[model samples]
Target: MSRERLNVQAPVHELIAARWSPRAFDARPVETEKLASCLEAARWAPSCYNDQPWRFLVADRHQEGEAWQRLFDCLSPGNQTWARRAPVLILACAATRFGHNGQPNRWAQYDTGQAMMSLVLQAIALGLAAHQMGGFDAGRVRQAFAIPDEYDLMSVAALGYPGDPAVLDEETRQRELASHQRKPLEEIAFAGRRGLGFMVPDSLGWKAKVGQSACPGTIRISIRTWLKPWSGLGSRAGGCSTWAPAPAPRRCPWPGGAFRWWPPMSLRPRWIGPGGWRSGKGWR
Candidate 1:
């Protein structure tokens, strides 16, 4: 099967770039060893204080009788529309309290997210597609599985081989073919201070272009560049502002080095008018 590849500005590992979620799953059952390996990957994920608070409840469609149907029933109707064909379903949960001291583990949910990513990446390595879904009846899951009150049921995942996108409805089929995109670096990253735009530096040997649309007072700046985060920005630093122009540079309290700026093509700033925010061009 042809896998959809990511359009990354900077180089990344092949496994990270190839990973994606698919709505259509073939009915073939995942091998027991492969499933175990996926779970094993999740088991090894690092967690806060090594709490290992993540848990999983799995159901395979090949299982006898209502075992699979019970899981299927927990899915929302929209998810059920495509997820019914998936061969395996899993519910991810996290323990809310620490085992030793019984204190609240604030990082439980975040740790569970890391574990789930490990599982998904393992599945991708095994040539299986794992799609995590938030659209499920959590109450139904708790009731069906006899989950303890201390556990938070976070999400459901569908796992199996990739299926033909033609099996999906027309609207979903189009979405399956759509390219993945991310917001430009300038929109999220900053240089000296908060609300200041960091232009890509030419010394990095990369090109950058800014697209803009204008209104009466506000302008939206869309930066297209191959820039990555250098060091940590200040905690209070804001993202691209919709209301104002780039603020003057100040002595950044952050000990990290300054951002190298490079000049490239034209960048148009979008304007925000009284009617409403006007549509503007952005990185694709």
Candidate 2:
């Protein structure tokens, strides 16, 4: 897993850093209890109005040989070229409508994605490898499993222990060895408008578990021309407006320190100001 870990720009949990999809799976079959734990983690994922719309159909190579082959048959040719080595296969599905209201729940697929995330993280926590893929025949799966039409297929994940990359083809071996990359934080999140990059200072980071230099904040988007600039609090950096924090000798999270940035519970942030600011500790 160390090879999978990349030097992330910001601090993230070891579980997240270590988690990566590997096409190479060991010959050893995944443990049943571990699979159950992964499902339990997914079961607790948050959903729209707690609808819990996700369902998982699991197939084990050692136990459910016939069922596993049915799933394997649905995979795209390229995916099957490698996925055949995995010991466990799972299909994630989401309800098309809310069970109670019978209305279209557009966020069902999103919530199912959250559940998959939880399951994958739990898999990594338990020293297993989990890889999700979208290359599969949805119609075939519905036909094979006799799935109800009310449910929409989300994705499929392969689960097992890490294996030797030597077995893979040249191109796949290169890809498996290559470092995985994610888009910069600025690219995905915007300050106010679409394509506007939201920036975060390097000093600001989250806790590994809890209470370890974590500085979480909520940011507000507004045009700078309409608001008064808080003196010595923050500057118009990257075209984002800055605000002042009241009360003397308080911690100014962004008082023109290493980088000018801030986020808080409300628009009127009471955490950043002109005085008593520490380098990393925020308020002195």
C-alpha TM-scores of all predictions: 0.68, 0.70
Clashes of each: 15, 2
Task: List RMSD in Å for every model shown.
Answer: 14.6, 12.9
Candidate 1 C-alpha lDDT tens digits along 1-284: 11222223333343564466788788778998999999999999999999999999888888633767898898999899899998999889999998888999999999999999999989877878788999988898899889999999999999998777779998776676555556765767789886786664322223222223232111223223333335663222112221111111232211221222212212322222222223322222
lDDT of each: 0.65, 0.67
Task: Give the winner by lDDT.
Answer: 2
User: Per-residue lDDT of 124-170 in model 2, one digit per residue for the tens?
Assistant: 77878788989999999999999999899989899998777778898
RMSD of 1: 14.6
State the weakest 10-residue window (summed lDDT) of model 1. Answer: 237-246
Error of 1 at 245 (Å): 38
